[model samples]
Target chain A: MLKRVHFPASLLPYLLVAPQVFITLVFFIWPASQAVYQSLLVQDAFGLSTEFVWFENFEYLWGNQQYRDTFGRTIFFSVAVAFLSMSFALILAGFADRVIRGSTVYRTLLIWPYAVAPVLAGALWLFMFNPTLGIIPFILDAFGRDWNHYLNGGEAMFLVIIAAAWKQVAYNFLFYLAAMQSIPRSIIEAAAIDGAGPVRRFVTVIFPLISPTTFFLLVVNAVYAFFETFGIIHAVTQGGPANATTTLVYKVYNDGFIGLDLGGSAAQSVILMILVIAMTVVQFRFIEKRVQY
Target chain B: MVEKRPGFTIVAHIVLIFGVALVALPVWITFVGASHDGARMLQAPIPMWPGDQFFENLRQTFFGRGLDGSRTAPVWMMMFNSLVMAMMIAVGKIAISLLSAFAIVYFKFPFRMGFFWLIFITLMLPVEVRILPTFEVVADLGMLNSYWGLTVPLIASATATFMFRQVFLTIPDEMLESARIDGAGPMRFFWDILLPLSRTNIAALFVILFIYGWNQYLWPLLITTDPDMMTIVVSIKQMLEASEQTPQWNIIMMTALLAMVPPIFVVIAMQKLFVKGLTETDK
Candidate 1:
């Protein structure tokens, strides 16, 4: 990773690297270690005394129906978000890739939402789906359906998923368009000369060529849904409507900061750390494989 | 060009128009909300068209008391806090990452890999996972309710460091050799050659990092309990909570618009750099 010819060993290098190493140690390593330590210790309700309880926190989490439900809910949320946003982006990119004109204009219009923050995204969707005056619910009311996400758990989950996916569509669109644009046009022309229609060509050739991009986007989207959607969930639902919308990350925040359950929160944090490490590993592994292409 | 079917081309344009409409729906709604008075916003089936209250709402939100009966800072102060946080994070991350990447690539130092791995480990431990303990650490250091608490912990970015490392690696070895032959020291060479070479990448990364910093919600939420230190993004949540009582849709929507405009403008204005930085760094 370094150059063949390098500077001689000196204290200057240490000084140069000190700021980054120091910040990482203090902010990242120390807190992570503290979470691991605290996961083994249970505190009383009054926050006065603590007892060492190894694996009890994890065991308790495994047995708790609510925690398990939250686990399932989080996976469902992530998968739905990935599927919805990716499919929509795939369609848009497919069309945008076909156009010989106005592609840049279409791309510019489609990609601005990537700049929006997750919480602001949440706010925007929340306003659009606001029960009394929201435009969407108003339209749904015309169909003789009552719409209230605040009171309904399913609707709350749906709203959060839509907001999360909406913000992510621009990102996925950019990647998909790039991947599509990189495919050699002569291959598609050959497919066309074989009497294959546009749909057939796309299904048989274009889709297979972009499989790597699909895989890469899958992992990235899962990570986005896992960690980055916290703002969307927090702003939109706050894990409300009987905790139906509380994903694993939101649960950690709710239990520790709001519920004051130190051991449980720490345990959740440890679990999340494992999840992140796994995702990062998968991402890097795929990235290395992608270099071959 | 591939054989074009008139029907297929028509279908493509129609689908694209629909997609754009779907994506722009929420922003349009927010804009329409911001452009109306409080009474108009409270009415059922809120107006889809813009109103003439845009300037009035801007005045009330920026200079006037933000939301009725809510004891929060004015919109301008929160925007100022957000700007400060974003600038500090972008500049701090670029500065430290440049220095460390330079050190790692150019110098043969003791524990070099150890330090590199330490920085890499931050990628796996996002602030969300270690919220409670990190909050405690910051509180213990008396950094709560301050700009440092808002920005410093978030500034140590592994992605930026790695990107700069990749940029520095691609520079030919002859440049460094020539600089050395001219009797230029390491820092001088870095300042004159390396920094100049990486200027475009730096600017591109600044756009991405600035948006990231400005868009932060949770870290600032945990640290900045004082209303005066509240960022516009965080204050939107507070106003949402207060809306349960007062329901000031106009002011809240106005605040949301104000919060999002700066970053959206940056992305649209620097579209090429944004796309380049995004595809480069994420891979």
Candidate 2:
């Protein structure tokens, strides 16, 4: 091992990072610990009265039927959204890589939605799905199909997934496109010269090379699906139509910020943190090795 | 790169066009929707033409009064908030990431690998996981409802630092050796050498971090209850939830579209930098 010695230059780097370090400790670590502490005691909405209850909040949260249902619903929503979005993004990215002459136009346009803030993205879709004024139902009605996101739970979930997926496709596309572009053209041409068809070449050569991107995106998208979709869900569904659209993070936001159940919200957050950490560990241990670059 | 087959090429064009259409559809909707007045908006198959009412809609979104009869805050106010917040986050994040990257890659340190993983772990947490704890931290420090609550917590993260470190590591050590032989101090060497060469990564990180900060919703929503302090994103959320009886679809669409302009402009304007930045990493 190289014996580590501090470089005088190192102080500059540490100084640069100092604000972040302070902020993270103050905002991230301290709040996380505070949440655990707050969880042991119940507090009123005014945030004034406090009563200590050992694991009482956790027990109440776990035992409640609504919490369990919301928990299951959240998992279902996360898994479904992640898989569906990534699958569509992957297929579209693969197809986009092959056909277009001026592909940069497509690339640039495709990534535009990602630039839209999630709040605006959600509003765009919600406006389309709006029962009274939205053009989506009108467009569907023209095709001999009637649609209402507000009335139908399944339709609402589908719209939520589509909304999430639409914003995300560009992100996945960027990674896939970058990876595909990196594959040596000569190597792909050599495979093509062997008379392998497009599908066959993609499956045998291109897919394996881009598998790293696929895996990385998988982890990235899954984490996104898990934690970040709260805004979309909140803006569009509000866990509506009998709590069908509720996800874990949304539920955390609801319970903590809205319901004023600080203890329960904190418990949910702790559990969520644990779940994320576990998934991350699994990715590093099992999946990261498969990434090519 | 594949051999051109005319028949296959036709099919590929169709697919590419279809993908572009799907991606572009929402943006087109936003543009048109922002133009139409509320009555026209409710009409089926929404008026395909851009309306002159775009100005009227814009007039209302910023200057029109709310149901409580308060004058609507200027669109520039929202833009300014976003601009200030995004700039703060970008400056803080870039400074932090670059310095951290420099320290890890260029300097000798004890427990370097351990620190690397500690930062790396943050990449997985995302803001969503740590938000609750993060919120509490702000509240505990009496920073809630302040700009620091919005700006400070966002500064720390592992992604950009990790990325920059990876890029910096690829720089040949001989350059640093030469600089050192010239009696340049470590600080001077970094400022004189590493900063210039790392421009591409810096540009890329700028776009990514700017977008990240600009797109933030839940944190700002949670921390700042004051409408004055509320970001454009949270403002849009509030507008979307406002009652149906008095709903102003035109202004809502306009505000939403208004929020989108800066980030899109940033991305388009910086497209070259974005591509160059990422491609350099693969080398």
In the order shown, the candidates' DockQ scores are 0.85, 0.53
How would you encode candidate 2's per-residue C-alpha lDDT over B1-283 as one tens digit per residue? 4776788877777887887887777777888888987878766677766888888788777665432322335666767788888988987888877876777776665556665666776655566765666776678878877777788888876767767777776777778777878988777877898899988778787886787788899888888876677678777777777735566677778888888888888888898766664443322
Scoring model 2 with DockQ, what do you get? 0.53
Task: Give a tens-digit lDDT track for model 1, residues B226-281.
Answer: 98999999888888888989998989999999999999999999999999989988
> Which digits, one per residue and each the tens of the lDDT, describe model 2 over residues A1-293?
11133355445656655565655566666666776687788887687889899898889988999989887877777677667767767777777788657678778877666687766778888888777667788777879877877778888888888788778887778778878877888878999889898999989998998877777777677777777788888888888867778888888888776787888887888788788888777666654365544
lDDT scores in order: 0.93, 0.75
Best by TM-score: 1
**A33-120: candidate 1 lDDT, tens digit per residue:** 9999999999999999999999999999999999999999999999999999999999999999998888899999999999899999
Q: How many backbone clashes does candidate 1 have?
A: 0
Q: Tell me each candidate's RMSD, in Å, in order.
A: 1.0, 3.2
Give every prediction's interface RMSD: 0.8, 3.4
Error of 1 at B181 (Å): 0.8
